[model samples]
Target: MKRIVCLLLFCALSSALPVYSLTFAPAEETAAAVADFERGQQLFHSGSKERALATLRTSVQRDPGHPKANQAYTLIGRIFIEQKRYPDALLYLERIPAVMRSPEADLLRGYCLVQTGDFAGGQAQLLPLLGQSFSVQDTELLLLALTDAAVNLQQPLNALFFIQKALPLAENQASLLERAHRLLQGHLSDIELEEAAFMWQGTAIGQDARLQLARRALGQQQQQKATHLLQMVLASDVTFPYWQEAEMLLQRSSMDSWFNRDSIGVLLPLSGRYASYGELVKRGLELAVREHNRTRLPVRLVYRDTAVEGVSTSQLVSSLTDDAKVMAIVGPLLGAGAEEAATRAQLEMVPLISLSQRAGLPQRGDFVFRDSLTAEQQIQSLVRYAIDTQHISFSVLRPENRLGEEMTRLFVDEVRRFGGEIVDIVSYPEEGTDFRKQIQSLLWEDYVVDIPPKPELPEFDEFGLPIEKKEEDKKEPEELEYPLAPFHALFMPDYAERISVIAPQLKFYGIKDVTLLGINGWNAPELVERAGRFLDQAVFVDGFFSASSQPEVQRFVELYRQAYEEEPTILSAQAFDAANMLLLGMDDATVRNRDDLRQRLAALRGFRGVSGTVGFDAMGEAIKQPYLLGVKRRRIVEIN
Candidate 1:
């Protein structure tokens, strides 16, 4: 049986016939004709429509009087209808003798006639299949024919009636049935469709229907119904597309009722190991708020603790919600915790500006904003500094892992963008202990060729034994080329330890003329100590250029020293900036809403603060240019 099935499959796949063709044979050829017809029917059922048609047509040619011949002809007509070949479809369908014309045949014939633009004839043919006893599929086809004919004649009411009639029969036809219902509703008067849509909005099947109605209402400036429908959608699923719209409507409604005051919330971690950083953020926020208050801006400050280990996240959030009653939130310097708090604030319909640098937070809602620069942004800054300020034009390096690989890619991209070139890119295994071989391959300084030995001379010893003189082989120096000289710079975005190891080796190989550029990861104390002499002429871009003399920066340094008894890092400065911006934007009553705040932030032009002049681009990224810093006398110094 398997062998026979395989043979039949092979034949069906190999043959070509009209998509809906069918064949049958005479009862006199009984067993053979029956087998062929059955095989063809199976192929048709399996979606091999053309092969099934050919096999069935062969059966019909061989035995025209067989009972299956009429069925085969009907099937062939149906296949043509399915394939949307109306002309060819009509030819095959008309051959189904009158006695074999069932409701399905009449439906197919109506469809073909409609396709050929004979609306009246198609309508007349399909009218009989609208009876109660017809199957849903047949009824659906009948209604389709009627709707097509009515639409062609510009009788939208008639088209609507047919669509309504088809809806019940299309219950199992999910997407198609919904589309038909929507079309039917669209044809009715506004009042009528509105009533029907409202009725459907009460049932499970009506959710999507109601959403469509709401969309239409919104489009027509019917705000009340649109708001109601949007609310219903949100109540049903907060993750619905209309949820954001609903939230906006809700906010607008609230504004209309109560626009007297503005509230702001700060989510700094004031009671943990990161408390000092959070306090710095709070100070910036306080300064902005003070300025707002003195200017008589309609704004208020509400603070929340995002303590890492001292309090549960839930309790902290609850305290903010119940005690603070904030309209917007800012701070929470840690990444994961800050993200969680931000998400909660969004869900609660409060705006949140996160101070962390983590990527992949949801940016869809207007309620969440990020103020830190991403790694890619930093890479761009470094690349720009290398090209624009330092005039460095080339790089050579190896990535330690995937992140290293990404850094290499970003560096290369920036180099190309700045009209520079990557002379050599070397990669090594992160776990490998021996980098000598990899370095040798890249530096090409360890090759030697064989030298011929001198002829030996024989001498006689005192014991009369012949003594042969053996000469020591002379060593030849290996040839090495310095590739870094032509290029003005070299980039090494690796761990400080590996960099410390490689830099000295690079200098030993006579590549000391070129400046060595390092990435953010190389800004560490260990690199200076380990690669001291080797790094004498090297220059790298650091996040924090500690020797700046700008008044604002100097004040920041003084304040940070006063508060922490130590100088500030770039991370602390960025945290300060995030806090400052969040609070400054909150000074306006219009910024109570997140979208308004985003616009305000984007419009900021050269707003000077602790971390140089801060502004934002369209993607909510900081736009401050990075400074070029070099290691001198074992200290990081800004290159004016």
Candidate 2:
């Protein structure tokens, strides 16, 4: 019965035909062929590819019409494909007659055709199966092959269609969407494009089609037509993927309608988990605006709270750009919300300086800029300082958590790049207080304590009788080893709360004369208040230090204290710098609209702000050195 089942599976045919067909063969010959086929399958699974192919071929030659013959052919073809022997795979796959060919066989053949550059043949083989029900994986393969074929043949419409079909199965959806937009733009006629726009309605591809049409209208000097098309997109869906481009087009069509050069939009989470952060950033932006207005031609500040229910960053950005017509935007302080706002600002073609610490926010577009200090920036500054100070060898005693792992990885990579070696690495739980074991692991063999000799036992008597014993020799107790620390430095990528507890433990273990490295989290007052004696001379990095003697920082801090009557945090300082950069750029008479403001901000260099000397690189990331700080006399102070 097992042999019969194996034979039936071997002869299973195409989707349109019965899997098994009635055939007569001598029992012995059929059994031998089946045995060969099973052995070949086992050999293939065991990685003996050449032997498996030889076995499968021998089975096919044994009984050409046996049910196992077709199975052998299929396995042989699959092996060829695996070996990248495309022509061999094609040869075997073509031998299976079309009427008996399984969907799997057709897929294999299509793959071979594509690999061999016979794209048209591949399309012919795979396109028919698109209508048939197949496994998700097989469907993905078909669409990928078709996409490749169409792209090779310069058939943009077909390639776009295949990509749209593959989107649900694609892991890299963003890449496919981007490729789809590129394919549709300037690749199709008006009528064909209109069909696609209608087909993919409410999608990025569809919105891009309308954008292309608007571009055509503008090129032909049809201002009203272009404006109407772009307005249609914005009116229907503010969440439309390409709405920003549409808004920009509409603004270009009628500059007077949405070009308030004197207005700057502010998007912040003023009511939620991040409300406090929003308030800090708002205070700084407000201070900078007031100071800017006093010097320049008063620019109006328009504020929007992102935490409003039923209102998204998309709608807020639309309101700011389309209605308030702000020349540029300041922030959405949190990561997720900041990314959304940046995407909208990008599409709207308004310059936005985001204060969120999210990585790659600026890559959204040319208009998006990030002014916040990031984990990478902090680590870079700390590692650079360590290398500069000749701290050659290091050890890491980090918390067993995500931030700890990330910072440790960054530190190790940077040290390796600077030709320094990491002597030891260990982690302690964030919730733990006893770090003695973890700290002990970082110490060298010289630090090991000596074991005292066992106390001398009394002399035993022979034959159950006590023997006279001389007085035992006296020995002093073994002393503990207190060796000098081996590593030049130790990096603890955790908060000050944990550092205070960990510092004394290091001292208890005789770990001294080693430079302690830290992230921004160590810049707290409690760090000094709790462990000042242990952490004296410890260095850390941060975007802002209120006690700094820099004139710009002093002025900003004084103004912030006077207005809010509270100490400003890094959030406030970064926002102030971002807003001031925008406001200062707006002061230029040539900056008449958002485009001009974007150019001015992108080209900004060496503008001193409270945070640091603010500038922008080509990717719109802030170019500034974070402030290096250290504990001096138990006080956190800016260090040279």
Highest-scoring model, TM-score: 2
Best by lDDT: 2
Off by over 4 Å in 2: 1-256, 444-480
In angstroms, give how far residue 416 of model 1 lies from its true place. Answer: 4.0
lDDT, candidate 2, at 445:
54
Error of 2 at 597 (Å): 0.7
Compared with the true structure, model 1 gives a TM-score of 0.52
User: lDDT of each model, Cα atoms only?
Assistant: 0.63, 0.81
Question: Residue 442 of candidate 1: its Cα lDDT?
Answer: 50
TM-score of 2: 0.61
* Model 1 lDDT tens row, 1-640: 9999999997886464333334433446856666668888999999999999888878766765466766766777778677655666677677765555776677788888887789989988887667647666776777878988987775655665676566667765454444344343233445555555565554433444555455445434465876787677667732233345446544433322221126666677787687877776766565446545666655666776776566654455545644665555665667867666765654444446666766644342334566665666667767776677566557566667877788787777667545466666767777544556555555444544445565545669999898765555434445545543546777777777778887777776556576777766677778888876777666665545445866767776776677668667776666556556766776665654444454576566686656643776433456665666667887666666
Lowest lDDT sum, 10 consecutive residues, model 1, at: 252-261
How do the residues 326-386 of candidate 2 rate in per-residue lDDT, one tens digit apiece?
A: 8788888877788888877776667889888887787776678889888888888888899
